[model samples]
Each structure stands twice: as structure tokens, then as C-alpha cells.
Target: MANRCLICDKKKQVGVSSRHHRGVAGKQWMKRAQKTKRTFSPNLQWATVDGIRIRVCAKCLKLIKKEQPKGNLPEIASK
Candidate 1:
């Protein structure tokens, strides 16, 4: 299983967490803050599209359901 969304092409992103503290040693300066690495992963789910099962994000799934035409209508062909 990959950490990517099939429909929206979503992927993991890198982030940082910084720590803040008060001044020390009676000086009006703060110590160097620490940074922690973090990853933001997308919410993905398994869904079937055009008879194919693949991973898609929640937003895309919602859009697909909303945009699908009602009743059994053939898709329009564009040149």
C-alpha cells in the first residue's frame, strides 16, 4: 500500500514543530528553539472507479458522487 491518493494525487508533506521558551540568565534573549520533523499524510480510501478498484481521497470521492449523473446515461464524448 502506497501513501498516495489515486484520484487527487495527494502525498505526504514535511513539516516542523518549534519550541518556544522564556529568556534565561537574566538576559532578554531566548534560547535556540528545537525543531521536530513531522509528516502530513492524506486520508485515503479504497474505491472503485470505472470498474477499477483504487485508492482515492475523501474529497475526490465526494466530488465523484456529487458529479455523477442520475440514472443510467452514457458519458458524452468530446473531440
Candidate 2:
């Protein structure tokens, strides 16, 4: 399965990772910490909406749950 949110099309994003304690205590290091390439993946999970399974991100899942009680899931899930 593709690692993407079906609702909003959220996917992994390219970013940089670095050590947080490199310049702590006002001590300047001779060489700065190198940044490494990384990917920030969205929080995705499988969900069943209107009898169909789909992958959705955490934020969209929250919205779906919120609207479920109002019987408006089909409208949002279809998007």
C-alpha cells in the first residue's frame, strides 16, 4: 500500500536532522554538527468509511471521528 493519506493526500516530507545538544551551555564547538537527510512521514492508519477502507492521517481521522456522530462521514470520506 502507498504511504499516503487518502483524504488530504499527505505524504512523507524530506527534511534535515541534527543533534540538539551540539551548542549547549554556551560552548561553541569548533565544528558544527552536520545535518543528515531524513523523511518526516505523516501519521497514517487504516480506516473504514462507508464500507470502504482507506488510509488517513491523524488530523483527518480526528475530523472524521468528530463528524461521525453527526452522520456526515460519507461527505468527508468521499473527499
Candidate 3:
């Protein structure tokens, strides 16, 4: 499977770790995403099985919502 999402081409994303401090100095590794995960990707990649062109972020699969409805119309127009 492709690491990047078919929509937005957000790349080079860094994951941060969150930990609670117990007065003493402490650090925790929050399993940051691999560098390879944040790589090159197409800006407008089409969706699978539906062909919905979208802009998404890799690994996160984020989509840019478009408030417009555009698609093919039926041969027979409904009244």
C-alpha cells in the first residue's frame, strides 16, 4: 500500500511525544513516524474505485473538503 494519501500531498510531518513530568527530568519516545513516511507525493491524487480527486496528507489520509457537487448527470433528466 502507498504511504501517501491519494488526496492532499502533505509530507515531512513530524510526530511529537507527550509525557507527564514527575519533578525529575524524564523523556518518553512517542513512536514518531518514520522519516520515510514523510516523502514526496502528488498534490491531486484520485480516489480508488470512485475516482474522487482529492488533496490528502500522507499517512494521515486527510482530505480537503470541497463544498461543491460536480459529477456526471444521468442521461434521463428527472422532473
- Top-TM-score candidate index: 2
State the weakest 10-residue window (summed lDDT) of model 3: 70-79
Q: What order do candidates take by TM-score, descending? A: 2, 1, 3
lDDT of 2 at 79: 54
Candidate 3 per-residue C-alpha lDDT over 1-79 given as tens digits, one digit per residue, 9 for 90 to 100: 4445433333444554454533433433444333332333344344332454433443223222231234432122111
- What lDDT does candidate 1 reach at residue 36? 99
The C-alpha lDDT values of all candidates are: 0.70, 0.82, 0.36
Q: Could you tell me the TM-score of candidate 2? A: 0.78
lDDT of 1 by residue, 1-79 (tens): 7788766678899999788876677764557677899998888878766676777778877766777665442232221
Which regions in candidate 1 have their CA more than 4 angstroms from the true location? 19-33, 70-79
Tell me how candidate 1 scores on lDDT.
0.70
| Candidate 2: segments with Cα more than 4 A from true spot | 21-29, 74-79
RMSD of each: 5.5, 3.3, 11.4
Which model, 1 or 2, shows the larger TM-score? Answer: 2
Ten-residue stretch with the least lDDT total in model 2: 70-79
The Cα RMSD of model 2 versus the native structure comes to: 3.3
Q: 33 in model 3: Cα distance from truth in Å? A: 20
Clashing pairs in 1: none
